[model samples]
Target: MRTHWLSSCLVLLITTLAVAQKNTQGISGQVLWKAGNFMPTIGTKASVPKAVPVVREVYIYALTNDKQVDAGEDAGFYQKVNSKLVRKVKTDKKGRFSVTLPVGYYSVFTKEEKGLYANLFDDAMNINPVQVQKRRWTKMDVVVDYQAVY
Candidate 1:
């Protein structure tokens, strides 16, 4: 019957998807900040005695681990494509985050990219990178230690 054939096809598709499941891993961490003694910028040095802001939201990125890919002529195209492949995660309250990603190399970061002060530390250094492997949970901690230039 026609109904029987349709059911058979649907069952076949579901089985194929389950068999092709990709192995993935989880990543979790906190974003902490240490009070700064000084942050030198633009030929001027400023002192930050104590600045313990809330550690509410931290960003985690499972970035594509290829830095040597040359865009060549179409430089903008490469950046666009690579940005699309980035796996981004944000922490919840209490500075906690967990993300499941495919097994591969990744570059993690804790940079803040929101709010009116977002562009303040544009020239600051990036956070250290971390790697995640197959079916494993990687616990990585990040620290923020920069002050505003102005």
Candidate 2:
């Protein structure tokens, strides 16, 4: 009798936990610069450089508010905004990025510079709406249209 009751309780707990799980999924995309936009190398003797989108490492941030993360506040560039640090991720060497987040709405953007995660640099561009869905990957690609902070 005791064994039967324990098994029933265990089953109930498992079901409840499963039902309580949040609808979270993976989000992935790439940051790219148009190949044609970059012209021949200045220092290189080669006139025709390989035409391809430049793959680089950049900073990415997920925000829950309409306010920009590092909006012109030089200090905000490298400082981690603990108040709104929902998800911060960096793109791979190929400029491919992936992050798992709960299903909901978020404003996403990328910083021009790669390092400076803990130091102030400059504001980011390409701010846009991002949505995560349940049980699937959401693809959102962004292009670096502005110059990186030196």
Candidate 3:
């Protein structure tokens, strides 16, 4: 009887943990970096440009408008942003990262040496905008390629 009771308690604990995890929502995705020559060469022995997984820090900020970001001379680099930073996460060796956040719209940026980097925008000019839904993990893949020549 004692063994039965202990087993029941263990099962209850596991179930509760699983339910708690399922109820939390956030974002999960990978980051890739493309560098060097990306333009196609017609000559023989030409190789395709490849993007590799990059291990870096990812920043989540409140949904940012175009005016909020101070654009840099390069395409994707930002000098700074006026939006509030919501959270930050570091990517694993394989460039995979996950973060728990409330359901809302957010802007994603990857840490760079000079500044922050993000290459996407919406119709309203929202920079790197992502939406986190209730009880769901939003998937977003960020590619950093400011150094690469097109």
Candidate 4:
């Protein structure tokens, strides 16, 4: 009787583990450089360059998408709880990036170079992120105004 009970318990535990693993999903996304300021040539004395610089070294964070959790406080919450690196990725030569993460809602974080570099979406990316669905394989898009801090 003792051996039969132990065997049954082991089987139950294995089944639970298998079921949990089956529910996991993979999440992914890409990053791009925001368009540069396009001043009208007709009005300006000097024409601005049409090409934009590539952004790099942007860091991403994951957070729970709950009603009580203020979306505006995501960065601060991540800093307090997930201060360590969740994942690190860089933009390719064409300013494209892809990262694979487990299914979960996440907030995007971008690091802009402190020097003469100009990054527009630094604060916004740090502020709030849209709730990401985590069921199966998923993909999303991210844009950065300034280059990521290397």
TM, every model: 0.46, 0.48, 0.82, 0.43
- Model 1 misplacement above 4 A: 1-24, 38-85, 113-127, 148-150
Instruction: Name the candidate, 1 or 2, with the larger TM-score value.
Output: 2
Which candidate has the top score in TM-score? 3
TM for candidate 2 is 0.48
lDDT scores in order: 0.48, 0.54, 0.91, 0.49
Query: Model 4 over residues 79-109: C-alpha lDDT tens digits?
Result: 2223334676777766566565665555555
Candidate 2: RMSD over Cα atoms?
10.7
Tens-digit lDDT track of model 1 for 1-150: 999999999999988855543344767777555554545456556555543434444333334333422233421112212333355556665566777766655555444432101111112222234567876778866545444221
Model 2 per-residue lDDT tens digits across residues 46-97 = 5442323445444434543324343445432333322344666777777788
What CA root-mean-square deviation does each model show from the true structure?
A: 13.4, 10.7, 3.7, 13.1
Q: In candidate 4, list every pair of residues with a backbone clash.
A: 56-148, 111-149, 119-146
Q: In model 1, how large is the Cα lDDT of residue 39?
A: 51
Which ranges of candidate 4 are over 4 A from the true structure?
Answer: 1-30, 35-55, 64-84, 115-126, 135-139, 146-150
Clashing pairs in 1: none
How many clashing residue pairs, candidate 3? 0
lDDT of 3 by residue, 1-150 (tens): 999999999999999977976899999999999989988787668786799999999999999998998988877788988999999999999999999999999999999987899888999999999999999888889999887888
Give each model's clash number: 0, 1, 0, 3
